[model samples]
Target chain A: MDADVEAARPWVAEASPTFITLIDQNHLLSSLYNMVNVPQAVWIDEQGRVVRPTETGGSIDILREFDPEAGAFKPEAMARAGAAKALYMEAVEDWARNGADSRFAYDPDAARQRVSRQTPETMLAHAKFQLGRHLASLGRVVEAEALFTECRELHPDSWNIFRETTEKMDTGIAAGEAFWGKVMGLGEKQYYASIDMDGMP
Target chain B: MTIVLTETSNSECVAAPSTTDLWLDADAVTAATGWTLKPEGFCKDDICVPTPADAENYVADGKVNVASFWRLMDRPAAASKDGDVWFLGEGATERNDALLSLEAPDFTLPDFSGKLHSLTDFRRQRVLLITWASW
Candidate 1:
């Protein structure tokens, strides 16, 4: 994607069209606008105010089912996507009808307030997840594994968090069981020693 | 309150209590950019200005020069180097001044495929920026 963007830059610049293409990598705009997932969009007016809440944007063709041989893919995911698409289409229609003065337009203050409600716990989980990724990148697998586990515990509903935690644990277990084995060994030792001591007593 | 002054080329660094009636470290500004520091103010991005003696200096230099600040903070300066340019300060957890209501730090980073993107890209369009990871 980076290469694609870079490759497209010259053409984008050469054309220098009236349309502007702004990129957001750190998700500052996403967070401020309360965007929760990819392909989501929020419309901002010329005055730097969010005219629309975060919603899925772009055209989407809803798929009701998939190839059965591909394994068990939940139908709920498709349902959710369909719902999201409907909401986004509605949002776009609203924007088209009203522009900046649309009835559905979001108040800047209200939008900010909504964003502020993104609980500290959510932010902490985000932080922990990031730290876990950082640690994993640095080869601190054990620490990263622990952090990812904590992140999942903190944000159980975050699919990415859960997936990452499971993946890290699986990889760690497969590549090196010493860490987990040591923990298990400690537990076993404590259990047997306690039982033996109790029996003697 | 102890004001830690760390001076470096391109900017002055000052760490003091936040005066915005909000939780924010005085170090956030300096850590973001390698500005020279003094009681009066700090300098960065070739902009030298004074800060409120009693107020938290969010950006003594109005424009955020992410590259310079990252170098000053001893963090990776380039997005390519760090994968993500904005790193939540390690000091945030420990410091009473850690920002709570402060706006998110401005940064540019690559997408999943390592594509560099900036906030300005989606400025005209309503953007639903979602931060998700493979976990």
Candidate 2:
């Protein structure tokens, strides 16, 4: 749900995806579905019940494998990431073919429960981010920045908040220095939270 | 205490303290301000503005007088003449409510060509909705 639809167009067009590639300039997707980072996928059944909450898609790890020389990730971590991606893809295919019968599909109640464990702080971050998005939409850039900063302060681990906030301000904070520095401060091990796909069919 | 928080824009939905006191409940404070109390402070993310030492005086019966708290921070908030309703700036209670339900809130946004599409359009289909940015 990026604001820079123009920038994302070339990549989406190049991929030639058959699926829906919609824009969310206001980032309602993030605000609504707890999508704190890109490529976080959720599963829903034909009945429109959410069967899975937002999860790391792991596509980024495929790219990480090629850039091992970047020195941020170890070869072991890359392999773990690759295995995770393969497992995720397999689960997606299973769900696609098996529908609600898929072993990967959780019951609606289970999925809802999983998604409901948000801390009050996280909820506040989500609220602040939505307000920031609203202000940004209205061209209240300065006010939006204050809210965005508050969001960032509230949820430092949320890449969606940081990226969207910086991009809106044209702060160039994501231009490799400030962002990377923050990441480095957080440590490479803390980059992406590991997902447990062990029970997925 | 039973301080009512009224948004300057929409004064009708005055945030009333569920508990009696001049202090607003943490929940009420959260509703009034898009802020939840955390160990670090009244936090939103990685950043936290520390709570002042005397903040407890402003809180009573598990509620906080956020207007008083805002004053401690020197932030701006409007108070009504009767001093019962305090007006805070914009908040995201509605959005947070939508999110807590885990139901994908319907939204419409244009593609590169400006053709608008709603999330409801993909109902009954397995959607791989991904968020990507050019930046």
Predicted complexes: DockQ each: 0.13, 0.20
TM-score of 2: 0.61
lDDT per model vs. reference = 0.40, 0.60
* Candidate 1 chain A weakest lDDT stretch, 10 residues: A191-200
Candidate 2's error at A152, in angstroms?
0.9
Off by over 4 Å in 1: A1-41, A53-84, A93-98, A109-113, A168-201, B1-106, B111-115, B121-135
TM-score of the second chain, each candidate in turn, equals 0.31, 0.47
For candidate 2, write residues A1-201 as lDDT tens digits: 666566677778999777667777655566567677776877765555667777777554332333436756667666666777788889889888988788788766666656634444555666455555555654767766887788788777778778767643364225355565666576464455555467322
Highest TM-score scorer = 2
The list of candidate 2 runs beyond 4 A from truth reads: A59-76, A116-140, A167-175, A187-189, A199-201, B1-104
